[model samples]
Target chain A: MVQRLDYLKESPSQTAGPYVHIGTNPNWVEITGVWKDDLGLVLVGPETVGERILVEGRIIDGSGALVRDALVEIWQADAAGLHNSPTETRGTADPAFAGWARQPVSDADGLFRFETIRPGRVPFSGGGLQAPHVTVWIVARGINLGLHTRLYFGDEAEANSVDPLLNRIPDPVRRATLVAPRTERDGMPVFTFDIRLQGDGETVFLDM
Target chain B: MSGAYFQRDRDWHPPALTPGYKTSVLRAPRQALLSMPTTPSEETGPVFGHDVLGPLDNDLIRNFAKDGGEAIGQRIVVYGRVLDENARPVAGALVEFWQANAGGRYRHKKESYLAAIDPNFGGCGRAITDAEGRYAFRTVKPGAYPWPNGVNDWRPAHIHFSVFGHAFAQRLITQMYFEGDPMIWQCPIVKTIPDPAAIERLVAALDRHETIPMDSLAYKFDIVLRGRRSTLFENRMEGN
Candidate 1:
């Protein structure tokens, strides 16, 4: 066995830019039939475990202007708290769930929406349970690198209060940025998660 | 182990002011939250394959003549290699690009119709990298256009490029400018890149040797992704 291992140095990052969507989601631009739909259009099917939910929000910049061209993607575990990954060693995850979704902000209102099931609590490698949450990745014009953050359910206050990662945040006020408040829009349950790219109420962007 | 150091650019990008230039509003804010340690979730990203690829008939110059029509402007070839920080080629990477027409007009609904549209030019192209991490595109030389950054402000002639490496986390998007374009020095968007080296990397050099001789002029721009500079994250110990 080798005593030491070497790794590749990470390359510097750059913004996703003015024409990202045209390249990534051609169908959305009226270029049709690339692959029926994008890869992350569905997070779960009828046979998947968990309550189906809709995640909606907008990407706001530092000046409080909506980022009309921003793209958002989410990844999470199934309702049983197991990831749909080939590397998952704990046990087999739900086969019906893909656990990922991607959407671009709408042109009219700059809002982005995803259809997925609410994720369940997952185990922390150390010793505790993490609150149920979904990881979100955001990219847009003027954004040098894709921003990383988490969206926790507002209704899951009990579990969130003691989440391993949540507890690491030094300020309670900043922690609030991660929670998606529950609301009703057009008679359907929606978790509103507005991402602030900068300024007064900047969303908590993770280092990774 | 060398300590992991991820220094946020103090000058590059938005939120940082560029002297004598406007147009940096709505950029991301600088905060402590962005500097916090990233978990495993942030480090790992999804893998992309043929599924996300565009149609095989995506070459812009060729498509420009699909209707037996011609795209207006100077024909040019832009080519490059996508490499990691280690200078190793990143094979099979996806490279996508979009730009304005020779008249500096985008073929989009939101764009103002002030500039004449080149019906033959779709203004978009994409290609997969070969084993050598090389990709190329054939298109017209885009024209400079006006923007709302400031009164009489104009964007330099540029083509936006997006590259997706093997992993999701390594995706990158940036604009490429023609070498020695005077507008680059004055454009706030180009000026926002803090580092001189980084700013220089955005420019594609004129490749006289690779020019199509009688057909088209060639330009080269090489992109380098982050190398093996993984952060030295400490192992989590219970009850630490």
Candidate 2:
């Protein structure tokens, strides 16, 4: 066996804390002019293609209190099921789509919202195609490490049934936590995914 | 092209339900995490360009200065290379950092610390790694602050770092403690990590060679991200 050099272990994780906004989203905190605007604020341009949609949710802790200090980030493929990353060698993703966004929870309501297009099906490394989904990561003052999870469309029931990731969790009720039911408001499609950090109905977090 | 896949070492990370860190009580998930192979989603990530950064983005000392006065505190320069586990340089990675002011107080309104905040010090800065995976930033040394986690617990002087690796699977958010700081070993958050060596990796060593004469000292803190599995392991898995 060819011996590999002793790899360096990962550094310990710490909480993002209450002041996370100052560093991640300086513009939002009134410390203007970091850039024209904060990065990840706009994932789609006017020319971007696909069905426009909005993903919104509130992060609730085990105590049933809203986590106002939380920061939520999303990464998803473009409408064509392609990523706008250099590692993506399959096909070019939509140049207009940024493919990522970060949003701090609302101070008043602890709600995090993202405006973007519906994503297409992405291929799983093992074999079959995965249902169209958005990868969600969350961090906050009390969160020691960033939590990883997924948001699947409840409307796509057929696709959701056979999703490789969703299938990994045998319990139907636990699996349902990953799917977000869709509703329409003001002529816009909105998917509500409430992430519970602990207790019953807690979201299925992934270890990638 | 699908590259080699490597599983995250679960043992390397601290458990989510540590009681010493009082916040983990209600925040930690009660259930176990579902392990999954890396998909295209995990292999790819967003790309940032140099055009997005302002000229003084890496200089915290003057980036938020008011009235032509710089931040108050001991000046220091932090520099290091972002590398993968295989020792390969990770270029063009975004490194964002924030910290308390010299008096151990944050600029936020909720800060109850008695220490006064320096008006000139915004206490945050960012830098992008070069082609060689090297990134450097200039700022004042942050002060240690006491928190409500315990009766009287003080966090060591540290800077919170958020780094983006080439892949989404490699993204990491951690803190860097100053070398020779006794408070590092006593902090409840630092004690959560099971491995002493891993905790040591979080400490940045003072590098006198890089220090500017009569100006600012330098600290070197190299970061290592998850690496792609070797091709040999891939062939073995396929029973080649």
Candidate 3:
């Protein structure tokens, strides 16, 4: 039996290297020629519509080690419940906000921070509104595939209770993993979201 | 289960699922909860235009090579087309990659490998697919290095790839291993694909025609994004 060699086979999967930062966020790695700044760093300008908020948290691996090299990206709807995307036919998202961000877990403590507005409630496919939440994607050296999750605002308790996706999680404890605790720091609303990759308090990582 | 294709086998990936694999702390079990709907928010966009591109984005080798200072190792050209599962070209996809240096050490602070740092290579690059879905990069061959996975376990020579197609749902991230690397079979990462046919698809062969006479060698690696499989998530609203 002979094998065909016309198109090269796609390579096997490997974890993103420790230096994914250099590629994804070149400016952070000090690769100056790439761009003035990395993409998704400033998702919202001053004119962006939304209740601006500070989202911060650490990514803890199962062994309790901080995934220092982890990179986190988030996507969400603007305050008007509109998405900043070309596919959005319902309404235009705030022109000032891209509604997306890519943040690296800080080397000091594996904490990732994003400065953006609190996302507005968006609709589910069939009907009804989802909770005000941010879709998150996480990648690091040990993670073969990027992990997907969501962070709902703790203050949006009513919306959280009715969120279609949150209701999908069968277990209450697991559902709790999706909510971000809210607080006020420096006179601004802050949402603390800690993502646990594995173990007792493992975050609810969505398969998509 | 006829005609149903699960992307990964539990045994092959996240090695901890296999009894006694030893990296239990990092492994997350494949649960029914993972299967969910992908909403419009999950998508990257209608297209990834030049807005996301960086100045030195396309050429990975020269970005880190520092003014034509040749990085130490074998120089090779990696070129390929980004296509849909149906075999159509996917133009305007953002293709990005990073890898270890010739000595198998990354430019990361946490990397403690004793190998000498290639003052010339930063190991990162990004290129947008052309109208024909073609992309290319010039880089040094990466070396194999031991990891904490197990005793004597060394990663195979490979390049990490991240592609953002027309939409977020079309995004893919995978590694391209060198053809004929003996470590392909031994590495747990490669075995994770489960299907023998799928695993074979990952190895890129050397193209003598692509090789530059007295200058460098070339390798061809084409990446196929989802077409019909993407429909599976259309109603579901989540998960890539």
> Which one is best on TM-score?
2
**Where is the poorest 10-residue window by lDDT in model 1 chain A?**
A4-13
Of the pair 1 and 2, which is ahead by lDDT?
2
Interface RMSD of 1: 4.3
Better of 1 and 2 by DockQ: 2
Question: Which of 1 and 3 is the better model by TM-score?
Answer: 3
List of clashing residue pairs for candidate 2: none
Tens digit per residue, CA lDDT, model 3, B1-240? 011112333343333243233443365433443555555566435345766665655555667667777678888889999886557787888888888889998886668878888888778887888899998888889998888767778889888888776555454578888989899888876665666677666688899998999988899988876542333433433441
State which candidate, 2 or 3, has the greater TM-score.
2
Q: Name the TM-score of candidate 3.
A: 0.86
For model 1, the stretches where C-alpha displacement exceeds 4 angstroms are: A1-20, A30-40, A46-50, A61-65, A77-100, A120-130, A141-146, A183-189, B1-23, B51-57, B64-70, B229-240
> The CA-based lDDT of model 1 is what?
0.71
Top-DockQ candidate index: 2
Q: What lDDT is reached at residue A155 by model 1?
A: 94
Local accuracy by lDDT, each model? 0.71, 0.87, 0.73
Q: Compose the digit string of candidate 2's lDDT tens values, residues B1-240.
A: 346446667677777888998887899998999998788998898888888889989988998997678999999999999988778888999999989988899887778999998888887788899999999999999999999988999999999999888788887788899999999999998887778887898999999999999999999999888888654434222322
**Residue-wise lDDT of candidate 3 within A1-208, one digit each (tens)?**
7995343332334556577787788678775664566777877787887788999999887677777888888888888877777667677778888877888888887888999998777877556788888888787766766677889999999998888888888788888988999899989999999988777778887754
Score residue B131 of candidate 2 by CA lDDT: 96
